[model samples]
Target: MSETYWDRHGIYGVMAEFEDPEQLVEAAKRTYAAGYRQMDAYSPMPIDGLAEAIGFTRNWVSLVVLIGGLTGCIGGFGLLYWIAEIAYPHNVGGRPFNSWPMWIPITFECTVLLAALSAVIGMLAMNKLPMPYHPVFNVPSFAERASVDRFFLCIEASDPKFDLEHTKAFLKELNPEEVAEVEK
Candidate 1:
């Protein structure tokens, strides 16, 4: 039998609780500087530069959305062209078969529809949604305070620099109110 990830680590990581968002941001920056890559922070509200401090530089969501929009635009225009000129060419009211003016509205509508749908699907896929469970939620206080008025920084055990005792000590040095182990 093989040891599972949960069994191997026996914990998710060490979490430090902070009362202020400033503390959370500073702690995250120090953790990142200490070479801890697999870490996350939570707060009641958005904190400017917090993500940058944690080394979150790039987001592929915009690229995904752009590709989706371009695809939609090209596909919509192509479909309209095929339908109007080849598939069902109708000589209605002496209008030309390749009348592009009338196809503009439907083509624009199709473009918007596909672009919107792709954006939604892309976002869901990128974020790995439908996650009904997470180890961070295992903490009793985290469940309630996470969305209210507290900030938290969790250093995952999976990080290369993570040593149970050493990481705990490191988090403690950050002067947090409390440091607790996160269970899997």
Candidate 2:
């Protein structure tokens, strides 16, 4: 196969749909046991134990926020320090050139502004947002019942252990109402 063929066909994984949330959770556990890593679960509402069943871990949003806040704090202080001490130093009303108190408001504002911007950008980048299309959206039934009553589990094509036959059989064993092979 050509590189493009592999790029298009290599990421073959099964999408299993379930009627009951509990069954979906159980199926997720079984899928995890079968060594599928690039899998996701969808539900009409949050289901307990689903995260553990699918081995989903907490995201790194907090770390991103912390780094952003720290950077903002440092940058704010540095900018104010440079302006007050080096750039156009002035002794207004006999106050010192390095006026720490006067710089507090600007420093605070800059810190908040940069931190908020970083948080918004970081979240978008981390989640891979702004995607124009997805293969899951191509599944006909997927659009009909995704938000109403059905639950879905999809194993992406990028997973290292993904095999068409094995994945189909694994999904079948989970007793899903329907198992569909998605193409991108």
Candidate 3:
């Protein structure tokens, strides 16, 4: 194939191929301890402790969804309450205008709808999705085996401690199958 990216512009990082997820997790732990901040791991399956090993354990998507749901619930009820009790009072069947029971269904629906929507939208926003392209894709043959039976760890050059030769040596020290450069 054509030389992808790092060849033309600059190096993206170093990628190491491992036989299994355990090895990848160990390597990630070592890299993290070595002060490599910008790194990621890919495995055929969800590898437990991998995220923790890489030092990423915080997320706020749930909080965002909760806030969205509450806002939707209150807005839904308030809007109808304003319309029925304040804006234009419609006395139907001599029923009370401040009929909280009548507004339950719409408020519940709004809460569910906003919660679901916020979960999806907040997750996407938090994760910065829709990125159809990433430098890690240029790691040779990563596309084929990464989702099959292999695990890969990439230490990005953007990490402060990253020096191409040093990073390559570091990955090799992890006893991976092979350590290679990732093109941008």
Candidate 4:
């Protein structure tokens, strides 16, 4: 809840442009190794090792889906049990009230349904969707070439190790095509 560097300076970050995905990956790996955690890389297509280079680990969405699935499974089975044993208490063909075997289909469907919904919602929340604007788009070269042929690495101002001049010099050492400051 404290004031961030961006809040104080109106600067988003410093960005470096790379022409090749390999260069981007290498630069990202070096950056991450240099102890920079608040950084991101951009590329036109999926690069094989970029995620690993950026130090991306486990995500929380899977946990969310797992919990949602368990909730649905338990809730579905409980609903059926309540209907059969307590709510209606109906008997058919002299069968027992707790006919659990017949609940498998409904329970499975509910599990799948809730898991799928959780996946969608979790992904949206995790990715911060509905974002119509970002400071990265403010860079002309990035806006023109990010989805075309260029790759980018941006180290945000909010990073603990971020010092404007020092970070720029560090990025320069990576031999990027161009390095620019991103304004908020």
- Top lDDT prediction, candidate number: 4
TM per candidate comes to 0.90, 0.80, 0.89, 0.90
On the 0 to 100 scale, the lDDT of residue 38 in model 1 is 85
The TM-score obtained by model 1 is 0.90
Tell me how far the alpha carbon of residue 58 in candidate 4 is from the true structure, in angstroms, after superposition: 3.1
Cα RMSD to the true fold for all candidates = 2.6, 3.2, 4.4, 1.8
Predictions in order: lDDT: 0.86, 0.81, 0.87, 0.93
Query: Which residue pairs overlap in candidate 4's backbone?
Result: none
Model 4 Cα lDDT, one tens digit per residue, 65-105:
99989988998999999999999999899999999999999
Arrange candidates by lDDT, descending.
4, 3, 1, 2
Query: How many angstroms is residue 151 displaced in model 2 relative to the true structure, after the best TM-score fit?
Result: 2.0
Off by over 4 Å in 2: 1-11, 44-52
Q: Which residue pairs overlap in candidate 3's backbone?
A: 6-184
RMSD from true fold, candidate 2 = 3.2
TM-score of 4: 0.90
What would the per-residue lDDT of candidate 2 be over residues 72-120, giving only the tens digit for each residue? 8778888888987898787789888887887778777877887788788
Report the alpha-carbon TM-score of model 2 versus the true structure: 0.80
Clashing pairs in 1: none
Worst 10 residues of 2 by lDDT: 1-10
Model 3, span 1-184: residue lDDT tens = 3454334558888999999788898899999999999889988888889989999989798899999999889989998899999999998999999899999999999998899999999999888897899887777579778889989999877776778888899899999998888877
The sequence of per-residue lDDT tens digits that candidate 1 reaches over residues 22-70 is 9999999999999999889999899998989888889777787778777
What RMSD does model 3 have? 4.4
